[model samples]
Target: MTPLAGIKVLDLTRVLAGPYCTALLADLGADVIKLEPPRGDDYRHIGPFQQGESALFTLNNRGKKSISLNLKSPEGLALAQEIAAGCDVVVENFRPGVAEKIGLGADVLRKAKPGLIYCSVSGFGQTGPFRDLPAYDLVVQAMSGLMAATGEAGGAPLKTGESVADLVGGLFGSWAIMAALVQKARTGQGATLDVAMYDALYSMLTTSHALHFYADKTPERVGNRHPLSTPFGCFETADGQVVIAVLTPAQFARLSTLIGQPGLPDETRFATDEARTENEPELRSLIEDWSKGLNTEAAMVALAEAQLPSAPIWGIAQASDSAHARARGLVQMLPHGVLGQAPVVPQPVQFDGVKLMTYSPAPGLGADAAEILQAFCSVDAARFEDLKKAGVVA
Candidate 1:
């Protein structure tokens, strides 16, 4: 049987983070029922459309069912509560107090279903000073000190190219949900997870945090270079940039040999890791002087022959289309009704030699409303239609 095959999730999240968490669960064989409002998830309106539908929504929300409900109505709330009672997990990413205001708070849901795992993915948390502050990926990236430590020297601090804060929050939420599920199985108890994007992103800045805590050193924007390790960053080659990471003394020796500077590793200024780090500017210059004579691919090949670590910096399309990525089943094309086929980056995990893959596309807005209500709520067809007419269920 697939992992989490029998587990059910009530997904009440709209945008990236919370939806991504539930999407991971769905890929793991959970029955994730995405509960949207009458108008559907806000992500569906985002740009980069695929055959008139949102590509962002489809990519993040696959292998799940969608149900639309008018939660502001009393009847709608009753139906939601009823559905929650039957679900194993309920996830939301509303602002701090919005869930409570809508009467769909963790406390309310867990009270009705004692074994339910209630997960709240928020900007800050439920009870912090900044809990109510508006937050997006950029806000968290800035507040978490990620941006402050991410750019080229002397340049303004830059946010990462992707929504790393949101992605990190989702990753942590998925882990927390699984851990809570395991605990529930052991103790017959549920859990309330307060996964804040700010906290999650902060926790991921391990090197920066370590430097600050151990040495009272704030990390600067060193671009692609390692803060402590010399010769462990990208360097320019004739064709393009290539990353050369020489962390060990042996690797440094090999790097010197590859760059045709055989005596450089023995020099006092570049002998040890610390000494080399201090003289990194000179080291980079000497290495790049040789590397600039070779194309990125040739430099990479030469480094590989010397048994040193190096790779050409790849753009998104290049990385996605790489043979290694295809061999690992990292790239997949899933069928979508609107686009016929949609490219999906699946969960990067394998269990017992089996990669987890889910092909179902993101559902249409309220597409499975009647079927879901029939199965979960046990509402007959006539009553299901009436709920639609009453504007309670869409």
Candidate 2:
């Protein structure tokens, strides 16, 4: 059987964070019923369109059922409560108190079914002074010390090219949900998980933490270079930049030989890792002197032959379209409404005896309302039509 095959999730979430968490579950074979608002997810409007369809929504919301309901209506809210009570888990990304205000809070639903796992993904968590403040991915990245630790040394702070804060928050939220499931299986008790974007992003700074706590120093952005090691970052080449990591003495010796600096490692200033790092500028210039004479491919070939670790820098397209990606099935096609077959990145880990499981594309707005209603609420055909007519389910 597929992992999580029988597990059901009531995904009352929109946008990136919550959708991403449920998407992972959907890939793992959960029957994720995505509950959207009347208009639809905000991602459906935001673009970078794929044939006039939102790629953001397509990528993040794969393998789930979609239903639209107006929570303001009493009938719709009751329907949602019914669905939540039936599902094993309820995930939401709303700001802290909104779920409670809408009458679908963890306390309310879990009161009806104590074995329900409820997860809330937010900016700063459900409590604390910053709980009430609004949050955005960029804002969380800036405040989480990530931006301060990013960018060129002595330069302005910069957010990552991707939304690491939102993504990490979703990742932690998913992890917490699965852990809660395990706990529920053991003790027959559920959990209320609070995942904060700010805390999630902040907790990922291990290097920064090490520096601050052990070294009594604030981490300075060293651009595309390692702070503690030499030749452990992007280096210049004839065609483009390449990444080279010489972590051990053996790798350093091989790297030195490849770059025609075999005798340099014997020098006093380059004898130790710290010494080599202290004289990084000189060593970097020496390495580049040899690297700039050759193309990236040639340099990589020579480094590989010398048993040195190196890689050519690649962008999203190059990395995604790589042969390795195809072989590993990191990218696959899922059926879509407009795009026919859309590329999706499924969950990377695979369980034993599990082949490549085919998944459905993200649903059209309210596409699964009738099916989900019948399954979860056991609503009859007449009642389903009546709810639609009343603007409860659309």
What TM-scores do the predictions have? 0.98, 0.97
lDDT per residue (tens digit) for residues 1-394 in model 2: 5667889999988889899999888888888999999999999999999788999999999989999999999989999999998899999999899999999899999999999999999999999999988998999998888899999878999889998989999999999999999999999999999999999999999889988999998989889888888878988999898889887888888888877779877899888888988898899899999999999999999988988878999999998999988777889898887999999887787667344443799888999999999998999999999999999997
Q: In candidate 1, what are the lDDT values of residues 28-90, reduced to their tens digit? A: 999999999998999999989867899899989998999899998998998888888899999
TM-score of candidate 2 to 2 decimals: 0.97
With candidate 2 superimposed using the best TM-score fit, by how many Å does residue 283's alpha carbon deviate from the native? 1.0
Q: Which ten residues in a row have the lowest lDDT in candidate 1?
A: 352-361
lDDT of each model, Cα atoms only?
0.90, 0.90
Q: Which stretches of candidate 1 lie over 4 Å from their true place?
A: none
